[model samples]
Target: MVKEPAVTLHLTRIGPSWMDPITNFLENGKLPDDEKEDKALRREAAKYAIIQGQLFKKGLSHPLLKCLHPDQTDYVLREVHEGCCGHHIGGRALVITRFSISEVVVSDNGTQFTNKKFTEFLTGLGIKQKFSSVEHPQTNGQVEAANKVVLLGLKKRLAKKKGAWADELASVL
Candidate 1:
């Protein structure tokens, strides 16, 4: 058997703070004391969402990009970064297979599922798309689970607060 290379660990060089005053404020109905600090904290959280997209798009090595569908070459940069705030923090893409499979379709109206660029790319590739029922997450089991994982990770990273739990999808098929 060939020996596999050891898995390397990566530090974000970015911070993660999940439970912050804004979170408490949003959840428990306590408004932010200083709007400046609140905005700054929120702005910080937004960076990770953007950074992850950047890492996938601009930062990926050719080999890594090869792992994604030809259609998704610019998908990371386009889908993740090309939405308005309150809607930008969508999920990452799941390749699920090789050689031009169907693209992902989510029912929920957020960055991942609702972007024009994403849909156009998938359709351009001649792949079919499907959606889980909106508001009810169970329709998309893969996404729901992925969301949990990303959210948990984001929470750990932020340690203060992140914005939302958008699409975090995957599929065994």
Candidate 2:
């Protein structure tokens, strides 16, 4: 009879994960060399907990959110945004889910913004809705200027390949 040795597998992080600093501090008490970053990490690490070798964020109003490494984020994003359980949420829904609704909202006079249900929702929440003057779009000059810059960048980058502008927006920003 021949005896074979048992094999063990070891996994390592190839690229720096967003969870590295927090996980290291929570698990190994390691901190960066910079004083500012060390202080910041300490502050941020206080809200996180390591349980059963996994990191979770303690939310004030929500339940503990499991922290995932960068490599795992894509799967989670896909699952939440377009997978079987997803509802194909748009930017407004994403913002409302991730952050508290503001006291006021500024938008253009588009039909989407002027819709009855949206107006009633804002009114129910006691959120003041403000619209830029239609005659003078310069009322929202800053936002328009920023949009113009982004469009120009996309135009230059996507000179002959307009179809890929959506993929390149993050880099341009």
- Give a tens-digit lDDT track for model 1, residues 50-85: 222222222333332212333333544454466333
Q: Can you give the TM-score per candidate against the true fold? A: 0.24, 0.41
lDDT of 2 by residue, 38-131 (tens): 9999999999999989899998998999877777677667766677657776888777688775698776676655777668666877999988
Going through the candidates in the order shown, the clash numbers are 13, 0
- At residue 146, what lDDT does model 2 achieve? 53
Instruction: Give the distance in Å from residue 19's predicted Cα in candidate 2 to where it truly belongs.
Output: 1.3
Where is model 1 more than 4 Å wrong at Cα?
A: 1-100, 103-107, 146-173
Best by TM-score: 2
CA shift of 84, model 2, Å: 3.8
